[model samples]
Every structure is written in structure tokens, then in C-alpha cells.
Target: MNDSLIFATEGFGLNLNLFETNILNLAVVVFGLYKFLPNFLGSMLERRRSAILQDLKDAEDRLEDAAISLNQAKKDLASAEQKAGKIRNDCKERAEAIRLESEKRTVEEMARIKQGAASDLNLEAARVSGQLRREAARLAIEKALSSLSNSLDDKAQDKFLRQSIKNIGDI
Candidate 1:
């Protein structure tokens, strides 16, 4: 076994100089990458963090603005509801006033009509009374004239006519 190990070593001997050169090259590349890549990667990571923070701040500002708008809208809606209630109350009051005015006018008109009717009735009664009195006087005169013509004799009628003519001449 020792002879075979010596034969394998002779076939594949260690090249220390080549190994040292490859190790030195690898160290240089690792050191170079460490010196420059970290700065570039750190700057990129910092920019990404700043961008994310800026986006978060913008989102927060937008949320605040939305909240403010929502509060304003609520206040506006409350004012609108109050205004609507006031308007409704005003309309009811105006309607009531109109109804009262109409009722008052109607009552006044009814009273005036009643008064006019009473006046017309009184005037009609007075006219009818005057006509009745005139008719009664005419009927009384005709009745007296008929009774006197039937009761009086021709001699008495002549005497009455002569006396009436003498009395008329004297007047």
C-alpha cells in the first residue's frame, strides 16, 4: 500500500507555486469586490429605503386629506339637513298663514253677504208696505163712492152738486 501511495504521488505531485498564485488571484478579486460592491449596494439599498419611505409619506398625506374631506362632507351634509328642516318649517308656517288669511277673508265675505241680504230684505218689506197702503186707500175710496151712489136719491144728489159748486167758487 505504501508503494502504491508513492506511485500515485509521483503521478499527481502538489504544485505549491500554482496553488499560491490561484489563491492570491482569488483574494484580490474578493477584496476588490468587497471594497466597491458594498458601497454601490449600500447606496442602492438606501435609495430604495428612501423611495419606500417617500411612498409611505405620500400615502399617509393622501389618507389625511381623504379623512379631512370626509369630515367636511359630513359637516356639509349636516348643514344641508338643518337647512332642509328650516325650509320645511318655513313652508309649513307659510301654508298655515295662507290658510288663516283665506279663512279670515271667507268669514268677512260671508258676513258682508249676510248684511247685504238683510238690507235687501228690509228694503223689499218697506216697498211692499207702501204698495199695500196705497191699495188699501184706493179700495176704501171706491167702496165709499159705490155706497154713496146707491144710497143717495136724485134730488139729494142735485143738492149736493149745487152746494159743492158754491163751496168751490167761494174757495
Candidate 2:
């Protein structure tokens, strides 16, 4: 009976010592975590802040580039419009000049044809007048010969006819 009591008391003392050792180990681990936690958390927060700042700078650069491109596009559009206007004006002027030239040529051609027609009419009239003069002369000569033949006696006629023949031969 006395040996059993001593064994129980010895077991209780061992359990108390184990409990104290475990509590001390837990306090040491807590202190170590407290000492290192601030550095790890601060590094993580600074990395996140730097990444956000870089993204904002990139966005601003993109916006500026877009504005510059927009301005360049507007300038190109204005230049293209000016060139189109000039081309249209040149075409209109050329068309007008062509029309005027065509009109002038048509007028000149009409005048040339009229002058040619007038010259042809004058030549035809002169030819007709000359033909009429020749016909009248031949008729007058035939009538004069018939009248002279009827009026002259046979002996006078013979003498006049010989003299007329000699004059015709001389002519």
C-alpha cells in the first residue's frame, strides 16, 4: 500500500513539469512571430503600391499618344480636303476652256463654208452671163445677113458679097 501511493505522487509531478515546458515553448514561438511580421507585411504593401503607380503612369502615356495621333489625323484630313478642292477647280476651268475653244472653232468653220459658197455662186453667174452674150451675138449676125440678102439686086449682091468675103479674109 505505501509503494502504490509513492508511485502516484511521482506520476503527478512528471505531468506538471511537462505542462510547464509546453507553455514556455508556445510563448517563445509567439514572440518570434511578433518580431518578424511587420517587415513581411510592409514589403508586400510597398510592392502593391509600386505596381499601382506604374499602371497609372502607363495609362497617362497611352492617353497622350492617343491625343497626338488624333491631332495628326485632323491635319491630314484638312490637307486632303484642300487638295480635293483645288482639283475640282482645275477641272471646272479646263471644261470651260474646252467649251470656249469648241465654240470658236465652230464659228470659224461656218464662216469659211459661207465664203466658199459665195465665191462658187459668183463664178456660176459670170459663166451664165458670158454664154448669154455669145448667143445674142450669133442671132444678131444671122438676122443682118437675111435682111441684106432680101434688099440687094443680083448684080449689087454679087459685087458686095465679093468685097465682104475679101474683108473677112483680111480680118
Candidate 3:
């Protein structure tokens, strides 16, 4: 039928005793926790927030430093590359100069060798001509000596000597 059995034991009993229900103690404990816990927890949370903000700022500063370092490194690399290029160009120019100097020296040496050869040839030719002239003079003198012995007797030699003396006196 109805729910009469549940309410048949007693009427609605409202217990207002503070010791039994512990409502006053609960209120005091909640009040103390509310007052003390906020001070401790709020200070801790503030410290954590400050630490996070400091970390963020430090990270940003580090990033800026890295950026500056990267820029400086780039400039240094460019400078090094330019120096290397200049050195390469200088080396090439020096090599070219050396080659030219070597060529000039080779040409000069060749010319000197040719001049020495020509001088030697001229000296040889002069020696041959002198020998030929001496040989011809000696042959002519021998032929004259043989003919003089055969054709010119004592009378002809005396006549030539007397005529040569007369011509010298007239001169």
C-alpha cells in the first residue's frame, strides 16, 4: 500500500548537539585552514610563478645571445672566405710571374748559348784561314827557292844584286 513502515519507528529527529555532530569543531578547523592555508599556498604559488617568469626571461636572453653569436660567426666566415680568395688570387698571380720570369731566363740563356756558338765558329774559321795562308806562303817560298837554284847561276845572282843596289841608290 503506502510507505508507512519507514516512518512508523519514530518521527523526524533533528540532532543539534555540537559534541555529537562535531559541527563547531568542523567550522573551527575549516576557518583555521582557510586562514593559514591561503597564506602558505599563495606565497608558494607566487614563488613558483616568479621562478617561471625568470626562467622565461632567461631563455629569451639566451636566445638573443645565440642570435648575436650566429651573426658574428657569419661575418667571420665571410671574412675568412674573402681572405682565402685573396690568397688564392695572389698565389695565382705569383705563379704567373714566376712562369714569365722563367721564360725570360730561358730565352736569355738560349741567346747566350747561340752567341757563344757563333763566337766559337768564328774563331775556328779564323784559325783555318791563318793555317791556309801560312801553307800557301810556305809553298810559294819553296817553289821560288827551287827555281832560283835551277835557273839562276852565280852570274845571274850577281847581276840582280848589282841592279838592285843601283835602283836603291837612285831612290
Candidate 4:
């Protein structure tokens, strides 16, 4: 009436049983691990791989966006630099033009001043020359009259007076 349902090998377990050694339990556990472990581990690995691939894809997209933004920023910076350079050149040209114009005006004003001074000098010289000529003529006329008074005899003076009077009457 004490029958324990344990199967035993005939030669190896002549006195031992499956319930004592737990060989049946060990076999079932080993068989279960062999049959199901690969599926469980493979599914877990596949999920992890998919998540890693998705993460890599997202990272790549973000990197591409960043690259585009960096390129646009570079272009904007270059455009701003070009505009700044153009403005600088325009300002330099304007400054040069203003300087040249100022120099030209100054030269023109100086030339006008020199010409005015020359004209005034010429007028003064002409006035002085005319005055000298009048003075010289007066002196010569006085010397001639003095000499004529000394050399003129009465007969000659009378003849000279008659001829001069006739010339005046004809004119």
C-alpha cells in the first residue's frame, strides 16, 4: 500500500528512484530550456535591434537637418560679409570723391584770386605809366620853350607866328 510512482532504470537505479534523484525533473527542465530559450532571447534581441535602428535613423535625420542649417547660416554670413564689403567700398569711394572735389574747389578759388591780383597789378602799372608820360611831356615842353625863347629873333618869331596862325585858321 506504499507505492511511490517513480520510474527507475534497472541497472543504474537498482536501489535509487526518480523521486530521490530528481532525474525526471532535471530532464524536463533541460528540455524546456532547450526548446523555448532561443525564441525568448531572439525576440528580445530583435526588439532591441529595431529600437537601435530607429534611434540611428532619427539621429541621421537630425544630423541632416543640422547640416542644412549650418550651410544656410554660412551662406547668410557670407552674404552679410559681401554686403558689408560693398558698403565699405562705397563709403571709401564717397570719401575719396569728396576729398577730390574739395581740392578742386580750393584750386579754382586760388586761381581766381591770382587772376584778380594780376588784373589789379596791370591796372596800377598802366596808371603809373600814363602819369609818367604826362610828366615827361610837360618837362620836355618847358625845355623846348626855354630854348626857343633864347634862339628866336624878332623877324623869325614874326614869321613863325604868322605861319602858326595860318595853320590854326586852316584847321
Candidate 5:
């Protein structure tokens, strides 16, 4: 039975029964491939083309967005730099103004102090002069009285006393 099953009725290539059936199967396969392969492969290729185009479009859009973002960042950086420069200039101007104001105030304060000192000095000089004048007058009066008492005799004293009495009566 195994031998019967394994044995071919006719030789390998020249058999009439199996050759016709194989030829029919080959024709059917060729016909099916010729009929279906173009449509299948065309649809598959179209789908792949669409996917690739979509990916390219997406990449282009992303690139455009990145360019726009980069431009915006550059603009922001420029604006920030301008603001920083303005701030630095403003700070420098403010510092200069403050320094000038401080110098002006310092000069004014020094003038005021000098004026006060000058006024004080004048007041002290006047006070000292007045005190010296009073001292000089007192000393002159005492010296005159001492000289007169020492130089006058008893007769001159009596005559001077009579002259003083006459002057007092006239007053």
C-alpha cells in the first residue's frame, strides 16, 4: 500500500494526467497574478506615497514653526538687550545726577558753615574790643586820680577843694 501510494503512475515529466492539471494550475496562478497584482500593488504604493508625503509635510510644517519660534526668540533677545542697555544708561544717568546733586549740596553746606564761622568771628572781635575799651577807660581814670593826689600840696588841696565846691554849686 505504501509503495502504491508512493509510486507515480507515469514518469516524472511525460505524464499526461498530472501535466494537464499542473498546466491548468499554472495558467490560473498567472491569470490571478496578472489580474490582481497591479491593483493591489498600486493601492499599496499609493498608501505608502501618501504616508511619506504626509510625513514630509509634517516635517516641513514643524520646520516652519521652528523657524518662526527661532525668529521670535531672536526678536525677544534683541528687545531684552535693548531694554538692558536702556536700563544701564538710565542707571548711569541717575548715578551722575545723584553725584552732581550731592556735590552741589556739599558745596552749599560748606559755604553756609564758612559764613557762620565768619559771623561768629566778627561777633567775638566786637565783644573783645568793647571789653578792652572799658578796661582802658577805668585804668585811665585811676591813673589820673593817683597822679593828682601825689602832686598836689596842702595849699593846692585847699584851693582845689574850694574850686570843686564852686563847680558843684554852679551845676
Candidate 6:
């Protein structure tokens, strides 16, 4: 009985020592984790937060640039539309001028053709009138000759002939 009691007391002491060792090891691990984990996690979180802020700033800058470019593009489009309108107006004016010029040229050409035709008609009329006058003169001469042949007789002719000979000797 006495030996069994000694053995039981030794076992109880060993259990107590093991419990103390385990408690000390748990405390050391807890202390080490408490000291190191905060710094590591804080640094990593700070880096991630900085990267997020930078990305946000970059997005803002890009948005501003896009807005500026959009405004410029709108201005350019408006200017181009004005230029196109001016060009269209110029072309219309030029076309109108050309049309007017063509009309004037056509009128002038018609006038010239009319004048030339009038001149040719006048010349033809003059030629026809001259031919008619010549025909009338030839008929009158033939009528006069026939009338003279009928009027004069043989006796009258001899008397008139003696009178012309006296007149010619006086001249």
C-alpha cells in the first residue's frame, strides 16, 4: 500500500508539470502571434488601399479627358457642317451664274441668226425687183418699135426726109 501511494504521487506531479509546460507554450504562441500579425496585416492592407486610391484617381482623370475630347469633337463637327453649308451655297450660286450666262448666249445666238436671215431675205428681194424691172423695160422697148413701124407712111416719109436734110445742112 505504501509503494502504491508513492507511485500515484509521482504520476500526479508529472501530470502537473506537463500541464504547466503546455500552458507556457500556449502563452508564447499567443504572444508571438499578437506581436507579428498586426504589422504584417496592416502593411498589406495599406498597400492594397493605396493601390485602390490610385486606381480611383486614374479613372477620374480618364473621365475628364474623355469629356474634353467629346467637347472638341462636337465643336469640330459643328465647324465642318458650317463649311459644308457654305460650299453648298457657293456651288448653287455658281450654277445660277452659269445658267444665266448660257441663257444670254442663247439669246445672242438667236438674235444673230435672225439678223443674218433678214439680210439674206433683203438681198433676195432686191434681186427679184431688179429682174422684174429689166423684163418690163424690154417689153416697153419692143412695144415702142412696133408702134413706130405702124405710124409712118411712104409719102409722109419722103416729106419728112426732105425737111431733115434742110435742117441738117443749117446745123
lDDT of each: 0.88, 0.85, 0.90, 0.89, 0.88, 0.85
Instruction: Flag regions of model 5 displaced more than 4 Å.
Output: 1-41, 145-171
List, residue by residue over 1-171, the lDDT tens digit for candidate 3.
Answer: 224333443655555666777999999999999999999999999999999999999999999999999999999999999999999999999999999999999999999999999999999999999999999999998998688768999999789768979999999
In terms of TM-score, the best-performing candidate is 3
What TM-scores do the predictions have?
Answer: 0.65, 0.57, 0.72, 0.47, 0.63, 0.62
User: Compared with the true structure, what per-residue lDDT tens digits does model 2 show for residues 65-106?
Assistant: 999999999999999999999999999999999999999999
Question: What ranges in model 3 sit over 4 Å off?
Answer: 1-26, 155-171
lDDT of 1 by residue, 1-171 (tens): 333233356467444554544978888889989999999999999999999999999999999999999999999999999999999999999999999999999999999999999999999999999999999999997897688778888898788779989999999
| Local accuracy of candidate 5 as per-residue lDDT tens digits, 97-137 | 99999999999999999999999999999999999999999
Model 6 / residue 149 / CA error / Å: 6.8
Instruction: Give me the displacement of residue 135 in model 1, in angstroms.
Output: 2.2
Worst 10 residues of 2 by lDDT: 1-10
Winner by TM-score between candidate 4 and candidate 1: 1
Q: How well is each residue in 1-171 modelled by candidate 6, as lDDT tens digits?
A: 333233465446233454545978888889988999889999999999999999999999999999999999999999999999999999999999999999999999999999999999999999999999999998997896567557878787678668879999999
Q: Which stretches of model 2 miss by more than 4 angstroms?
A: 1-55, 145-171
- Considering summed lDDT, which 10 consecutive residues are worst modelled in model 4? 6-15
Q: Order of all candidates by TM-score, from best down to worst?
A: 3, 1, 5, 6, 2, 4
Candidate achieving the largest lDDT? 3
Q: Among all windows of ten consecutive residues in candidate 3, which has the lowest summed lDDT?
A: 1-10
The TM-score of predicted model 2 comes to 0.57
Residue 49, candidate 5: C-alpha displacement in angstroms: 2.2
What TM-score does structure 4 among the candidates reach? 0.47
| Residue-level lDDT tens digits of model 4 in 1-171 | 223433445533243457776988999999999999889988999999999999999999999999999999999999999999999999999999999999999999999999999999999999999999999999998898778778998888789879989999999
